[model samples]
Target: MSYGLDAHTIKSLKKAQKNEITEHYIYLKLSSFKKNRQNSQILQQIAQDELYHHNALKKFTGTDIKPNIFKIYFYTFISVIFGITFGIKLMERGERNSEKLYGELGQKIEEFKKIANEEDRHEKELVGIIEEERLQFVGSMVLGLNDALVELTGTLAGLTFALKNTRLIALSGLITGIAASLSMSASEYLSARTEQDSSRALKSSIYTGVTYIITVVFLVLPYLLFSNYVLSLAVTIIVAIIIILVFNFYISVAKDLSFGQRFFEMAGISLGVAVISFIIGYLVRLFLGVDI
Candidate 1:
């Protein structure tokens, strides 16, 4: 059954074989963490498919290959924190990138092409059937997260310039953040109720509120830890950028959106507002002769 592949083709097959094995391990581990019977079953099915691919490729190399231990743990951890859909989609992006390699190999070997087609078919089927709760309420989470980022970042930046005391700025920011979170949640609840059912509205508000509070806590942590106002402000801005980066990456993976564009837009707007607020605060402080 020798297809008489060249050295380069053989090497490529081995690399792909390793990737398949790695995904098999990752899917198996992720399935264990899922409480939902359907999701667990789907993951198990994917794992088996990956194992089959690994074995088929093993015939070419005439040797067994070990899975990547690092990737398995890394993606498993990502699934635990970010939800199953996000982790799976992120992994799928890797697989998509390898499609060109598959096509190249397929041109040389018919078996490789057949396998690539079958895998693509399976991917489409799996994607259509997947359902995750977190993804379902993503809009609500986005509303909360974006509002918190824009509003709190601007407010804190203004306070940082207006008040020189770290403790005082942090205290003021905390109080304002809590109050804004509650107001945002209530507004979201009302808006959702107007558009959807009461139950969904309530759930949406909860997601929004929880997300907002979490964002606020992260944004204010630097001020609480650092005594220097300028240093705290710098850390807080960095934290805000990181939050934007992480959230945009997750959304881009799960929803098939543009990561760079969304990330830069969100980050730019937040930071731009902060800069404007800082200037405004500085002018107000100077005009009022406030020395705090």
Candidate 2:
């Protein structure tokens, strides 16, 4: 069944076919990891749909295509580490160009339109129903992460100027960070207890504490590694911004939020507090006449 397609069109169709087959395998692999019967069934359905799309494209190209093995393994590893919802959503976002191509091709071919519509409607509905514990406690993670970024960044910046010694700054920041993380965890536990059961609340507090400590370790590492206090502080702020960028991007993709807005807002608040703390540190050092 020759559609009288040009070489270029056929090539593009083959690429799309490969993508569909790759995702079919990816979804199939991911479904096996799901313990929830409903979630597993949903993934299985999506995998079948992807397979159907691959065969549909193959008809136009009149050729066999291999699935991308690297993509299948990469997304599977990501889903295992980060949770299935995030990994799947990340993969779907990467397919936006393919979806656009389908839309363009749909104008010329009726079959492409049907495939495009199914991709847009059915798969999304299936993915939306997937439940994961990490996502359920995302708010706890955010609370811990945000507080650590703002409070610890400001504290470290203040210590950097006040101490003017890398070792001293790191020591002070570590103590402060550890103490703050414990306090935040306890507070979160109490707060969550009011809204949910004790077991879930405990889990929430653990997530909060672990996330806070992780952020603290990253922020303080620069001071430990670098001798120059100024450079250490500079690196710490850069690290803080990077943390914000990465976390916001994850949240944006997994939760379908606006990346730019959340990223800028969090970055602005954290850096602004750090700057204020730095000035305060200088003023306090000047008034106290401390020499280290």
Candidate 3:
């Protein structure tokens, strides 16, 4: 059930967790100064990563990692929390610290130089930061939710072609939402576990699962409030459009895509999907004639 922990692995994990916790504290502290949606979301995301590192350390060592308990009164928190900003400033200041680290720092860590695989060495350095996995999964899951909100909302909207009863409408929505959420989450978890690449797996699962759930959940909301199937459908479609725009904007801004490119690309893709889903649903209705 347990394997002996390597000293180097232990050291790497400890440093990573310490860095994460310190970063978490900095974000929490930042909350005192500003209250923007972007800042809040970023801070929360960063906090999730820190917690994840702590959890990973626990899994590896079967011991509680208390960042606060490490040192009674030490200020190495600078590297943990401020290292990222420092790196950013270094680049901003137009000085390539890359030379110093690879040339000088690599020489200092002679053991690292002995490792045959340069890639492995880079990977180890990458893993030395604990907050990475957390940032990746959590952020991706949020995107998944956004996708659900847009797509499933569109589904129910298009489904208005079926029947007119509000009960049926709400019932349809309830069915879709619950089913989508459970199915998506389960599928995501399974897929993620099976994946070899941690970051890729997390991103795929979160994006797919969350989007699936959100789309289904919103699809049914109109039925709850309106008796007219057409009206519900119309509102759902409108909501879907709004959601799509928001989702597109989100990806664009987050990824630094050109506004015009993001707009047309997202619009084209979404419209195609919507059209296809609508066609499929309509054909099914015509062939089956609502017997089920």
Candidate 2 structure lDDT? 0.92
Local accuracy of candidate 3 as per-residue lDDT tens digits, 154-184 = 4654565655466775787677767776677
Worst 10 contiguous positions by lDDT, candidate 3: 87-96
| Local lDDT at 67 for model 2 | 93
- Model 1 residue 265 CA deviation in Å: 1.1
TM-score to true structure, per model? 0.94, 0.96, 0.45
Cα miss at 273, model 1 (Å)? 0.9
* Model 1 lowest lDDT segment of ten: 96-105
- lDDT string for model 1 (1-292, tens) is 5578778877878888999999999989988987878878888998998898899898898879999999998898888899878888888888874567777778877877877886787668667867788888999999999999999899999998899888999899999999999999999999999989999999999999999999999999999999999999999999999999999989998888899999999999999999998898899899998997
lDDT order, best first, reads 2, 1, 3
Name the runs in model 1 displaced over 4 angstroms.
none
- Model 2 scores worst on lDDT over the 10 consecutive residues at 121-130
Question: What is the descending TM-score order?
Answer: 2, 1, 3
lDDT of 2 at 54: 94
